[model samples]
Target: MNRRLLGAVAAVVALVLGVGALFLLLPERGQGPAAAPASTTSAPATPTSTTTAPRVLVDGPVGVPTRIEIAELGVDAPVMAVGTTPENAQEVPSSLDATGWWRDGAEPGAPGNAVIVGHTASVDDAVFDPLVDAEVGDEVFVTGSGGTVAFTVERTETVPVADFGDVAADVYRSEGDSGLVLMTCGDWNGNSFESTVIVHAVPTGA
Candidate 1:
């Protein structure tokens, strides 16, 4: 999308950076753990309504996602709502075993894109360590208050850090059928990653 559109959605879908231990900029490998890396990607685009019909907000538990499962990759982890940090970047889950959902973005199974993020590596095995191995057609299941929503992976891209902003805008934009996005660090270079792995999926019916 355009720069103006990305700016408009900045408040709702802030970019997620400096997440996980991999993002750290510590000394070369074998020295010690790394420090958090500098921000790389830009904020997301505004999510448009899925339908042209009048919008209606449903009260009560509106299916807040609780867990995410990718059987093909042997990933099953708890999901938690995460908001932006004081600096406006999205916050990741403190626990390495959990994944963070962009709370201000679209809800899973809804019309917009539901963005979920996990660390590739941390103190121990991170929740999305195997995400880079995910392939097209893999099944991703997200369980929430509403129920479970099934998505079929459509594609995967390893985007250079400098180009992440454009890719993120398309992945997180809310102008299409219900969809899902999974993100993590990529291309380890001893000290830090040079790229970001982004997986795009669509609802089973879509």
Candidate 2:
């Protein structure tokens, strides 16, 4: 496959993953507070129901993310909006402490993969310096006008410029449930770009 085209496609796929989940209003993905100890002194005990509380998901207007916080990685950064670059590649955040979410895809709580891209290196601290260190099950919190949505890291991989097709299929998938994909350029491999680091996460309930 053409290297440049593949690279560009991967970038756009990442972009799609970022925006794909923007509209889905998934229930908060965390365990709620423990139920209070059953009343021990009550003369008559009230019957306890087994049903779980209904999950309340508020679908707000197509929200533009304002912030993203990954507590495990100590990454709390502002999110910016971007589109394609002049070279036709996806545009990236200009600052190291910020990430750009492609507005072309679904809004944050939506039912598709929302892609968030950032730089891995710069004169200052890389916005995603610890992204590679992220483990499955880690939490990613995105806050927007709609509300804060929580995502749990599900998978991470590095895709070479030449083998972008497989990952492209995965990231650009529109048939599945809501998800998020975080992307960044990794070490250079001499030909084009070295590889792309991607993290796939899904809304979590804890």
Clashes of each: 5, 25
Tens-place lDDT per residue, model 1, 167-192, is: 55576686667788998877766555
Worst 10 residues of 2 by lDDT: 17-26
lDDT of 2 by residue, 51-118 (tens): 22222334432377767889999988878776543333445565566777766665666867777877
Q: Which stretches of candidate 2 lie above 4 Å from their native place?
A: 1-8, 11-62, 188-193
The CA lDDT at 40 in model 1 is 45
RMSD of 1: 10.5
Off by over 4 Å in 1: 1-5, 8-62
**Residue range with the least summed lDDT across 10 consecutive positions in model 1:** 7-16
RMSD of 2: 19.1
Q: Rate the local accuracy (lDDT) of all candidates.
A: 0.63, 0.58
lDDT computed for candidate 1: 0.63
TM-score for each predicted model, relative to the true structure: 0.72, 0.67
Residue 94's lDDT in candidate 1: 62
